[model samples]
Target: MADWISRDDRLPVPVTAYGPLHLLARHVHRLSDTGQAHEAITAADAYLVIARIVRDEKSVRFLIQGKMYALLALGRVNEAYPLAIALLHSQRAAGSVLGEAKALCDLARIHLLGGHYVDCMRNLARAGVLLGTAPAETDRHRSALCSFATAATAAELYEAAAGAYEQLRHSTSSFDLVHAVTLLYWGLRLAHVGRSEEARSRLRRSAEITRAWLETDPDPTITAMHALALAKLGETTVAEKLARSVIMELRAGGSHQYARMAHLALGISLRAHGFPQEARREFIAARDLTEEGSRPDERPIIRFELALTALDLDSGQASRDLFETVEGQVRELWRLRLQRLAMLRQARQREETEAARARAEREILRDPLTGLGNRRRFDLLIGAVSPAREAPLTLLLIDLDHFKAVNDIHSHSVGDLALREVAAILRAHCRQGDEAVRYAGDEFVIFLGGDAEAGSEVGERIRMAVAEADILTDLHMTVSVGVATWSSGMTGEQLFQAADSRLYAAKWSGRNTTAA
Candidate 1:
């Protein structure tokens, strides 16, 4: 066993079996960090054996989760899923909310890498809820770290994540520096979404905090992230200098992943600042490093960057070849991603269908008697069709005159019948492109897609049709209509306001009228 451990380059085991299991996990982590994934897997298997023999549940669970994490990190997520599920169940059964949350977050990260955004969001939301209820300080820190990881994968969640990190930054003791680096990650994402000023402020604080921590003990990842933020801020010269220093350290230490990413950043920054030749060299170096490290997934990004550089260099054939290669890889990736998405969507549809079948779902704004849209739906329809300047649209507001007399003279059921008949008349006469909505108890709104005159013609046609329809023998309903057309300077709200004002004017002038 000692010889096996020595051959594996793992730490010497103490007399206690659990000690060896712990050391083996650490050894596997180190191997993985250095890009020796095959060796890491071998060591991880050995650790599992020791963990089983030790019969310590905590050590065994920790080793198993670590092994699964390493597997996911190496892009073997299919193999990691069963292990992750088992870990999650075990943690939950033990009331280890923090552990369960962390496991969920890790699973989410794997899904994110595979482009399963919905699944990723589901797991992240669960983890966030559990983290909110976690009791201990250590658990809170762990949860915060997981939250940061999930947020980093999905850029849309950057603002919420930044707030979470800010809260955790003040409370956490362990991995304080790592937390600072995580904040920088969120800051970069915020910057990508056009929040440049906010991003710059957060990044500046993160760099200051990280630099202070690194003064005592250097972290290559923090240095690389800082360089990336500087690049985003357009400080290309300073960013390039920092990135080069990280690259040298990574190359010397045999950390190919960090070196590859750093070089890619340097290449992009150089290109942005008009150093095409140096940028090409850096991109090629990044590509070579990733290829040498045998990371196929990382290669596509580097190849895409190389193709872009070739396009700039005026090498059309070379650029085309690189683009074709990237296109093929992207198609394959998208195929797998779509297959996973279809599975998730099918599952969600089944759940929704079952739930929808269990009850008569009520539409909040529906006419209870006629099964037509009510006033609320009408307002929503009007709000939904607010026009852009590029497309001219028209609105028609119609109100039934003396509607109260129908309810007062006839039974409520007869009044309801008359209203339903008038709604049908409006619906039948409106063109296919026009939307008719019940605006109030006895009023309707129509949105049309034609010029002003056409809209007025359609309104008249609806009025004539309603006049011809016979619902109740003694009831006659005449609709007062107002037409409003959208112009380049109008917004949706303004259009509605203008149309509504005209509608009231028409009603006041005469009981049955159409005014533009």
Candidate 2:
């Protein structure tokens, strides 16, 4: 397990002075740093008790922020809502624009997890306005934007959500556990929005990237996110182990909020695996953490899910009441969802039409004969290739061996057939994100996006494929491939020249070979 998501990219959050809020934060950080969820929650609760008795608005807000942060870190969606809603009102009363926006965003998060799309968007819109009106750029703007993105995902506004998350996942502070937990929600929302595979990819990537930090110390939220992703992707054994491990870690840590969320995640995974009884027990454990007045909306959330599970198990009165209470609301929201989706789809029609037209225009850069992108297309690609932290792009210059001789003996028609066949082979080998181009007659260039290490493997695969296939029966063909990876200082011309030099080296060494 790699310990770094890159040394500089994901360092540990710096420890702060241990005020009650800061102390709670330090313990709260343990959810990711040490998996001490139980302790964190207990500490927060103790703090809240003192703050409520003292009842100073400033102190109350401070304590509430600390506790709310703990709850959110633990992924306690239901438990967090009532406090979040109250915080929103309190912040508005304080006339702290940034705090109010942050509060609105937090409330949106609560609604989002509850599947309250309308409420989520409503809060997001109001938050966005407050965020915009803020005199200067602040963390509240960023937080509000994240909530907007989450709402977009919950609303199944995929295009917007996709774009929003693409920016957010890159922009958020990776070292912060709260930000890391948001990644879980980002992934869940992605899955709910019908981008399941995308969600799996993202979550697993998060796991792989965070494995280093997690290996050094256990983090319930990251571990849980990883487990959930793996389970969704059908890696049941490993995922189950990871998910079950969270309970032990949470209990050991003794953080109420983190324990609640961990159980909730485990319960969802269990439900997916057809363990309704096990799932119910996990959900109940999560719900038991709630105080009567903490989240009145909590029952409907759990009950709705309980009713579904009860259908397969022995559902009780609570499940029936929840279903009866929430069923109409769920239906109405779903109805609104369909309407929203229809309008979104309609709005996209013109956008799609414009895209199609642009695509047609771009096709002018495609080679008419082989259907691979032509030199013109390659030029555009080269121009777009800023030497940022993109994948190390490999340029493979593939030239047909003894091509002039083939035309001399077999006729240009046969030569054309060979070129077309080679193009077809390139097309077959490349996927959606890979780029293949006809650089010139008898010469092709392929840009293996981020697959630089696979240069030899890809070349070998293509060479063997060409060797095995007969474009014109009994007329065997081979290609000499030259590969060069782009370096930070290299220009497009330099990259092309390096690959070209390798091509010549291949030609000189052997008629049918690859040189890198």
Candidate 3:
């Protein structure tokens, strides 16, 4: 263990100060994203030390979450569980329901690994209740939902798990590792329900996605799952070979938790190849690995498989006892399944209601024609700005040149198209924290963090872009832009008036130009 920890000398140095916490956190996330779990842990540990010293609760929570992810990635579920419990307590003390929900989901992940299906479902149910009022699109919400789906799979809520995975799959990019894992787990669920063909397709797609970027050094955990998928698909020879290699890698890397699954994969393939005796050994080995405080969530499945092999070996009474034990476990799982179903129904209703409310709110704050923020959103932004501004803020006011003429000549439809195009251009130019708004007909506003000089440069680019737009080629469309930097103690109205004056000047000087 010490050797493995010391091997990653190339890990990024932890941030020395609180200000660089964001950078350090990003570094940890990037390493995690690239499947560098050991490096991620080292980086996160460094960040965690600084975060604790600064007493920055947010940073501490984030660092803990990052470390938990890295530990789970390395199949160190035992190490992650206490962190998750601590996080849950912290979140509860902070009075943050959403954060608490996410923490519970993290706990569910631990329970899922340990073959604690009832506990997993119980945690997920509690998380669902906490998330009742949270925004559906938030990262915390999405991550919690993913945990729910995984737990649902283990708890035998096949339909619910499938639906949740499908929803998440549609929302995530194909290149995302989360998306690949979602597909992989969804495939495993499908296989559990005897949808072998669909399971194979999903597993294949997941493998392809991982292979796309992970060609150099693939994740052993995913490779092990892929091997299991292959075994389920009856590719016994290839599956056996791949599973053996994955088991060796996982064990050597000290990822004994995932190594158990690798053993299960090997067992499956060996059984498929008619070596029931050898397969039983692999199954028992997998079960034995659950000792020493390891999560035994997988033991149920392993025991079931061992019982099958026992029957094949003509150990009738031993197999029967194993089956009876498994049946008792199944009965408990079924009870949890019923509770989970009720929770899922209630959660789904809440989500749908909240989604509806959110949609209505967005529609109110958004411009229908341009798809930009409406005047209402502009008001909200301006109202939030303090008189003693902390940073330079520049506003750009723009008006389409001769937009009325375009409507008169080409009809109102063409005018609308031009507006949408301009809106898209504005959206493209604005930075992540900037705002672009459709103020009114033929008028738009951009709020950015910079001085007048920077604002003028952006205004000039927008003016040029609008003038050269191919969609407006025949119409000869152009725009006049005015840039105004907010002065200390200036009200939103004063800022607007200043930009308006500059915009009038740009129009007077000749349209399609910028004035600062």
lDDT of 2 by residue, 1-516 (tens): 155745566545543322334444445445433546566667767766765675545546655665665676577877788888788778777667777877776776677677675566666555655555566434545655665565555455544555544555565544334333445444554554456777776666555655655777676766765665565556766777787888777767666555655665677778778898988897787777654222333344454555566655755777666555556665554456567656544544544565567779778998988999998998988777665645678888899998999999999999999999999999888754688999889999898875556876787788888878798876999999998888887777888899899999999998688888
**Tens-digit lDDT string for candidate 3 (153-256):** 55556556656666666666532554555566556545544567888887787667655644665778767766765665677797788888889788888777
**Model 1: runs farther than 4 Å from truth?**
1-55, 113-115, 139-144, 147-168, 172-206, 214-223, 244-246, 261-265, 292-516
Best by lDDT: 3
Q: After superposition, how far is residue 257 of candidate 1 from its true place, in Å?
A: 4.1
- The C-alpha lDDT values of all candidates are 0.70, 0.68, 0.77
> Clashing residue pairs, candidate 3?
114-296, 114-297, 115-297
- CA RMSD per model (angstroms): 24.2, 19.9, 11.1
* lDDT, residue 351, candidate 3: 56
In model 1, pairs of residues that clash are none
Model 2, poorest ten-residue lDDT window? 292-301
**Across residues 401-473, which tens digit of lDDT does each residue of candidate 1 receive?**
8888888988778878888887887778666457677767887888887889987898888777777667767
The candidate that achieves the highest TM-score relative to the unseen native structure: 3
Off by over 4 Å in 3: 1-40, 43-67, 73-287, 292-296, 300-330, 388-391
